[model samples]
Target: MADRLRVIQWATGNIGTRALRAVIEHPRLELAGVWVSNPDKAGLDAGALCGAEPTGIRATGSVDEACAIPADCVLYMRQGTDIDEVCRLLASGKNVVTTRGDFHHPAGMDPALRQRIEEACLAGGTSIYSTGSSPGFVTEALAIPLVSLSRRLDCLTIDEFGDCSSRNSPDLLFNVMGFGQPIGDFDQRQADHVKADFAASLSQLADGLGLVIDCWQAHGEYAAARTAAPIAAGTIAAGTMAAQRITIEGLAAGTPRLRFRANWYVSRDIDHPDWDLRESGWRIRVTGDTPLDVGITFPVAPEHYAAFTPGLTAHRAVNAVAAVCAAPPGIRTTVDLPQVLAHLPAQSSAHSSENLPT
Candidate 1:
């Protein structure tokens, strides 16, 4: 048919592995290379790392090695906030679509870091876009469409609830999220980061609605585990913090108008028994003249829910590759891009040689 866009799958972690699979399966994308940060994963076949059969493309630990490969886009799924590496990728002339939570808005980002990314985009004529399950899909992609139905919208609220017991990443669960820590010892820095990240998402939504936010605030609460329970991360001791609820609000004029709320529980039986419990999902409530409430239920097994979140995150980035490549060189967001849908390729028994590494 037509020439497919060449894509590099960077960092084969939870989200990266899913992005690799999506890139391989899409009809309009070619798997150019795979980049991994772990030294042990270097030189391994992309297929092996992603739980599929060997596909010839090997993972490299060095970003320079991956950047040297000819590619139209890079699906960057690395965890943690690293803006410098993102700028470097854009400077290499490869368009980027990432699941990183930090790049939602330019105003919320560090000014110098934002300037560097803009300079790189201008120099190489490439664009970079970032998204994730919560900040990207639920808040913007899903909420924006629902809000469009309103004739007179006053305020918008988005809530995400997930049971994260099945997630195996210790660093993400206990360390980053403060899952097993005492309520008193919970890390304020992580909470501040969450506030900033979600605030950026809220600001993006405000911009989409043509509303200017005058003030922003963040609130957090923790619920201790009632009893010891086994989680993929580790054993939770009784009375340790097992649930966290965070709300970030943006005010227009003098009212609390926009709200982004997240509720995470390591186990379902945590202190807030009244809290809505489901396999996993998000709810959006738009309040005004015509109040609208929408609930998206992801009815997967609890064990599979952990994988489902990252899989959706990766898919969002992968689906946006073409739009980013075609756009003018700059930082783009969901509000700026056209409707990007999943282009699933037809199933084939024989592997396509076109997807093989050069």
Candidate 2:
């Protein structure tokens, strides 16, 4: 802990706030600066934004200002799909860790954009890492490790089931997810856009396990609300789309070998009994000689689960800062980095021992 990594937290929204807090509380990290999108948030203390004691590190609206600060890494949590700013940060000689979906991997990225990111990394001699709960931990990080035990692997499937009723972002729920639209109006193609990202992870897994993917396919379905469901975004009519299921499959030599399934609903009582439902958690099942099944549950109150997802996303990126900084200059994934362990402060153990009875 003698040489702590200096971290600059970019953006301070739901995910950013959690990353900011983690950076502040981490035993091996130092808060150097913060970048915020809102002009009003500029000059406010970073600790205060995360609801912690003031650390005197003010958030700035200028990306230039944040990048100029002497820091070992930047935890980029801004809300958007843009990777231009992220590449710029890396080009400034700061290792980057982000939850932004676009930079999840360069495998599916546009050639020009991917080249730009590679150029930036080489120019600055810094590395960038991207991870989150779904495209990241649930499918690749969690499921891929389980595949190692398969002696005669047949297929691997990862399913994530959760209720998004409490989600606060109208843009995410209505625009991106098409939650309240009529079942007929929901475009399967739009929903299939995520296939590329999932495919990238599939490719990573295939490469790791020494398998070749012949082709890939994506499918989507929706469930209507049985009754009017009033959510934070708006009211979902009795017949409107209340839930969704998306499946991406990787076929190896005409056989579906790897699949990623996601089921998200407003509530469990929706009119889709056929679709699987879990209050909130991830399930990984591998079919082969030694079949394996693993369930990871996030045992939080229903209302709190909405917030828990973002925290997990942020922590995944924040926890990788050290490993990302130590890695060779380039875009990296969880597969390329060492096992990232959650290292608590020494005082935590000492404090626990002090409370023990003699």
Candidate 3:
């Protein structure tokens, strides 16, 4: 514990690169190695993957090779399906901070995988956790503030409207719009499925609200010529964008108690005369005995990618791993962790690890 927290970053995706930068900036964290699935990425330096100078951290496709590196924690940044490897890392006695698929919640995940990690952490005395922006921090922020006021909760809604052309890949855009052919192709695959998208947030919301969810509903919509906007160029066709509207209803012992709606969109079509802004973000409206509405929108473009917000979410998720490693092991929500907000310097004391329970 005397030296910095040795960290291994696996999966060199956008979020992974963001985590790598964060680890580099963090005085307490040390980037030890990098892991990748692409064989072509082997032998490459981790830092170079982000267009930075090499950090002497070579990228390896071999899990064993990466695990051999002296690391106290592993940052998993792959997609949701990559969670199997994350579990393996956790079972290998390495504390994990992953952004990959799975590990979002304890209730719905495979009991066998959960048991393996539980047993592994118990045996290895390490920790494993998953995090991202929507499911990671925003969900926590919504629930924690609510706990201060009334106890009974009714519904929660989160809407994110951001410029996706800047941060996301083309496939992501297609998925948001549900635009691929054979509708089943995009619908059937768990990776592209909307169920996996809101799983974490809904789970976190239910736990935070102290409600049990029975079932939920998700809807996807896309418009080719919905709206129009004038960009730096001439008038550009809007509404040719993709958008999704999601609703999740929770039940308290089979009685409907809470409901949530989340909407995500790309394209200039969502651009309205009233919302004449450049950047995009989120709007969270929680309706209960006392109504509270808070919206975060960006007027101008930010220096970082829009997806970086999710990266921040992922960063906090991995950071949560360190906190849980200090205590017992189980599925934890934002409320269960420390109440410390982002942009604040991490306190060295134990107070940084304490937050509301789910």
lDDT at position 53, candidate 3: 59
Candidate 1 residue lDDT tens string, 1-358:
2799999998888888878877887889999999898999999998888777788999999877888999989888776756777777888899988887667887678888889999999988999887877788887888788888877779898888877888888998898778888877445565677787788877887898888899888777888888997998799898888888877888888887888878888877777787665445788889998798888887566555555556667778888888889999988888888887877778742443223332
- Candidate 1 residue spans exceeding 4 A from truth: 81-84, 165-187, 224-242, 266-279, 348-358
lDDT of 3: 0.58
**Model 2 over residues 78-115: C-alpha lDDT tens digits?**
87755778777888899998786666556767899889
Error of 3 at 319 (Å): 3.8
TM-score of each: 0.86, 0.87, 0.76
Candidate 3 per-residue C-alpha lDDT over 1-358 given as tens digits, one digit per residue, 9 for 90 to 100: 3566678887877677767756654556678888887788889887677655568878899977887787778887765455456556666667876655466576676788778667767666676666676655565555467545766566666555545454335454554444221223223343225456465556765665567776654444433425554332233254444343444445556654544445544444542333332346666666677777777764444444443354556557545545655545554445566653333335432211122121
Top of the candidates by lDDT: 1
Error of 3 at 31 (Å): 1.6
Clashing pairs in 1: none
Evaluated against the true structure, the overall lDDT of model 2 is 0.81
**Shift of residue 7 alpha carbon in model 3, Å:** 0.8
Q: What is the Cα-based TM-score of model 1?
A: 0.86
